[model samples]
Target: MGQFTPESLAASGQAFELTTAGGCGVFVAEVHGERLWIHGAGAVGSKNLTQDGLALFEAMALAGGCRFIRFETDRPGLVRLSKKAGFKTRAFVMEKEIKKC
Candidate 1:
């Protein structure tokens, strides 16, 4: 929403906008290499992202010939959405090195 900036989007690639006439939501995707990544997604006054959002992603993948899609967000709700949309989660480890000898 208001959190995005033209400069930020320009950094990723060419900028564009699409509104779903309030029936869905607004999302921005940029083609990275051969994949289109969701740069932003939002539905005003809605707690959950619109189903159209999912469709938009699907359409992009199909059009771009993307065989895989990757997304990560800090929002737990989004994680749930991803799961509901047929995604699996994998646990990973983070190790830090302590150097003092």
Candidate 2:
């Protein structure tokens, strides 16, 4: 079983949208304005994950009142999954962490 710790998610600028029973897997997100960014890896070939994944992602965007839902995944399989769920690759963003002295 896997867990999506709130502390870790929050630190990563993400939110936990949903999780499976017995701590199987979780659907996490990074909300920016109206965007709910999801980054999850569930059990292999789990049908529940496939269905719940799409629903959860859609719900995230809707709950945030977003007109568009965007996701980024370098994994070709994951990208295909997102595309099937009506998402498209838009632009890329390069991020760098800053530390305060």
Candidate 3:
């Protein structure tokens, strides 16, 4: 995975940043059909990370006319927060690297 700067995200016109009193979050979103898909996001490791992220998601959904928000993350803390935000696991991804001579 790669990290994105707020300026870069803004240049792409598909992402935004949410800054709260306690922390800040970066998110990238896309509207497809009736749902808003959050391709990626990251927040400073603070107590308000979850709050900032959720608020950003809601704002994007509202502005984009999307009925739902979808995103993926492997962080355990985020997993727990996602559950709190009413998200359920849909699938798991596994990968391995192969070396060639």
Task: Please tell me which predicted candidate would have the highest TM-score against the true structure.
Answer: 3
Q: Among all windows of ten consecutive residues in candidate 1, which has the lowest summed lDDT?
A: 43-52
For model 2, residues 1-101, the per-residue Cα lDDT tens digits are 46866566566755453455423455456667777776553444455566566777787688878766666566777677777777777988798987999
The deviation in Å at residue 66 for candidate 3 is 1.6
lDDT of 3: 0.76
Candidate 1 shows a clash count of: 0
State the number of backbone clashes in model 2. Answer: 0
Cα lDDT tens digits for candidate 3, 54-82: 76787778887888887778789888878
Clashing pairs in 2: none
Q: Which ranges of candidate 3 are over 4 A from the true structure?
A: 1-13
TM-score of each model, in listed order: 0.61, 0.59, 0.75
Please give the lDDT score at residue 6 for candidate 1.
54
Task: Name the lDDT value of residue 31 in candidate 1.
Answer: 68
Order candidates by lDDT, high to low.
3, 2, 1
